[model samples]
Target: MKDLVIVFPGQGSQFAGMGKQWFDGNRVVRDRFGQASDLVGYSLADLCFTAPPAEVTRTRFAQVSLLVLSYAMYEVMTEDRKIPVSAMTGHSLGEITALLAAGALTFEDAVRLVKARGEAMESCVAESGTGMVAAVRMPVADVEKCVEEFNSGGHDVQVANYNAEAQTVLSGTLDDLKGLTAHLEDRGAKVVKLNVAGAFHSSFMADAVPAYTEALHEVEFTEPTVPVYSNVTGEAHESPQSIRESLAVQLTSPVRWSAIVASLVERKAAVWVEVGPKQVLKKMLTGAVGSGEVHSFDEEPERVRAVLDQLVELKKREPGLVGLCLGAAAATRNRNFDTAAYDQGVVLPYRKLQELSKLDQETLSDEQKQTALDLLLTIMRTKQVPEAEQRDRVESILRRTGDAGLRTIAGALAT
Candidate 1:
């Protein structure tokens, strides 16, 4: 669970009725959609469930709808279980959803920021004739060279998305893209014009940056509870200030998606959950990371239930402080062979921890949890376990359970 990385999708993955199942099955999800509708000044539920494909696909409508749906899926998935997320990230518009998942932004604020962002991008498109195209089965280097050739010839085209090693997205003027499309096909790469509104992640969207940045400034960005990768930097955002700056410039910045995947792989992320409306990110992971347990929560009901059930089983199997204390008591060799001290320290606290572990974890108050942790540490200390090792074990438990209340106690112990 410490290796779990949850991802969200962005635009182009949306479709009519994308989140219908969750909307119908969960009242909280329904409420979230309602809240989003109010914030965006439109019936998002209607747009997602009953609107025509053309209407739902518009950038202004698609961005917020996908955000709400993705965030709702995330909420439903984690409501009853704790997912020890190692990190979270998203494609272009999905980065906003990632922030929401990581607790950096409230749903209301995310909705407003995304709404303004979508509107700003759409406005930029209206002012200029620009679009995007996907170049597949081509090396990123070759694709960049093609883009460079076009740019050197006075075209504004740029490689806007390094989606994968073999898939890249280019954005520029329609005429220039048309010419580039023919050139790419001639080079043996399949080029499909993307159904997008503007030359996103290119200088063509520069005007939108100021507007999006203005909206960004109005919202408060707190430190993420878990790491959230940035599309602009292809790395984990370091701080709230960094997030603010990265997001402001994201409009005209290429989505370094391949770089993000490489970073996750470097971190040895072993389990990936795409908690969004489509399997786009899941497919991307298969080609990028190459090996991992990948699940698309939105693809099927059974898949979603399977992941939730697995988390529940994992939580039950986590022995918490009891396992730590008992293992240390049994494993650490007796130094002084002080039997009475061992009985008073190790045996007594180990029994107490066993009893505490039997209680419903949710029913345990913060004081009780802290007391149990303290008992485990004392037993480890009595058994002559290294202080650093004890801290490591405690931190491992914290990572697996992601218990914020326990984190407070762990932080105090660290000091």
Candidate 2:
């Protein structure tokens, strides 16, 4: 099995019919949804499949729905596909889902916890005039400088989510946010407003802290089966008190997503699967892991299965393929396909042919085979090894293959 880090998504990732396909097709998901509905006192299936978008988008409902759907996806990926989860982390509300996946929280307690937390957040939002805005293409230091400058002038804006290398989310009063946007834009940052009910992960959430903390007391946090990163510290937590405290502080703490990804990379996370309703986390991971393997399970079943098959083979043959594919996926997601950095790693080129030699000719589509070939070509072209020796080695490997398509790719690369 691949060393997979299962990353869950947070708000802004939910929608009606988010997990309808899985619910309709999988008995386990249906059963899990039934239990969640019982615990939360509402048919999550109804709200997720047919409720008005507005209702589902409410903080209370949105949080619950995202948790339920992401949990269902986790069940499908782990129980059905039998994918081993190495470590887990989440963005915002997703941290709860990660906790559940890690076995740190029971499903029922998790449901109740998020429901209480969401209601508290919604209450806070209803009583405050606060929101969040994205500062794009700006480094964290610059965003912090902007926040400091604004807060020094008696404004209340603060960093909420450190989403990526170039993205940061600020939460504060609407008027303050509007003013800060201009200041941020002046500093060469592209500011885009987010449609959130309140300024989560800021001091505005202080009022909700006690209620969330009280609710957390009711839940039992067990030892996790896998390493679970805390959004509060971007590190792993094992103690029950530590996990509980982390969850409460997470409300008022900047989601250290960039830091969490860095930590995962440091541990050599072989593959990252964003098990949620959308591709949001997968996109953020690209810039963070830089040519690491990432995949999303929100697509049609065939596509998901195909990707999983490829991942299994990649894991078995060339683990480094995970990083290459991740970088490539990140590049594709960000609309930048240049692989200059990917070509520079010394060991990447050495095993290029060995990795390609295991491709399943019958299982992979033509385009999939070509993609592997293209990566091999890129890895080979770098000055990591002598061209003649690399060519001889690759040709030797190709001659041993029974795959006609792979050989055809070898011929193309030869000329």
Question: Please, what is the whole-model Cα lDDT of each candidate in the order they appear?
Answer: 0.83, 0.76
| Maximum-lDDT candidate | 1
Q: Which stretches of candidate 1 lie over 4 Å from their true place?
A: 315-415
Pairs in clash, predicted candidate 2: 291-323, 291-327, 292-326, 292-327
Query: Which residue pairs collide, candidate 1?
Result: none
Q: How do the predictions measure up, each by TM-score? A: 0.80, 0.74
Q: In lDDT terms, how accurate is model 1?
A: 0.83
Which 10 successive residues of model 1 have the least lDDT summed?
403-412
Question: Please, what are the lDDT tens digits per residue for candidate 2 over residues 251-300?
Answer: 99899999889987876676788888879988888767866778788854
Q: How close is candidate 2 to the true structure, as a TM-score?
A: 0.74
* Candidate 1 per-residue lDDT over residues 52-148, each given as its tens digit: 9898898899999999999998889888767667788999999999999999989999999999999999998995888999999999999999888
In terms of lDDT, model 2 sits at: 0.76
